[model samples]
Target: MCVEKTPWEQVIDFHGHTCPEIALGYRVAQIAMRELGIKPTPSAELKVTAQTHSCALDAFQVLNHATYGRGALIVEEQGQHNYMFEYTGTTVRVFITINPEILDHLVIPKDLSSRREVQNATLEAIQFLLSSEESMFCSIQKE
Candidate 1:
């Protein structure tokens, strides 16, 4: 006898893949950095996991657009996993993962190529995201 599979099962099975999510995430990060006037780092992390599967692409795109016209290295670090987005050089490494509990952080190198300009742009982006209602994910409040 043949058995039928549920729709949820099918959907889950489709989402179970990781390649697509990672690729899209990387692309979104690249576009966002470019728009912000910062060069994208050659290395980046792109992975598909339960926590990052749902809106990985959307998050990347939104963050990129929201930060457009500004400058900052969007470093998404979830736990030990890290993704660095640079604005003026190639990335040194790229690590992909499917683990939850990973965190994301933005780091502005002390000696960035364009220190003054990049700092100003980074500040602007941070302020804008912090103030916007849609910045829930982008803002990291100090405890």
Candidate 2:
């Protein structure tokens, strides 16, 4: 029997491997969906603007269907983990800014030379991003 993949599994497959940035993106995408209400109409469009570039963008592509190729996704480098999601059918746009404190906490120590240690650190960070309370890791505003 063919089984369906969970959104997280699909995102990991699209992004190649699991990492903190992808987890961050996954959370951002999920929040955007909640704020905007899934695809409201058949013709509604989703436009995404990312404040900084990272593997997280891939999550938007996979989960939100906001792809760069179709010009639905854009990056304005402000060196921030901020994201904006605009749905054509909605009057309000959602803006999410990841908490800087959380980002700081997730940083891996540079001195760890062991590959297993690096992987463990990365996984721990990913788990935090995936499970933390929305308010704990980011702030959401609709405008």
Using TM-score as the measure, the top candidate is 2
The stretch of ten residues in a row with the least summed lDDT in candidate 2 is: 100-109
lDDT tens digits by residue: candidate 2, 67-108: 999899999999999999998767778999999878874577
Model 2: residues with Cα > 4 Å off, grouped in runs: none
lDDT of 2 at 54: 91
Write model 1 residue lDDT over 1-143, tens digit each, in one string.
87776532333343453233333344334433443443244353222122232324344434433231233323334433323333334433323332232122233345657767666755654443333342332322111
What TM-score against the true fold does each predicted structure earn? 0.21, 0.94
Q: Which model scores highest in lDDT?
A: 2
- After superposition on all CA atoms, how large is the RMSD of candidate 2? 1.3
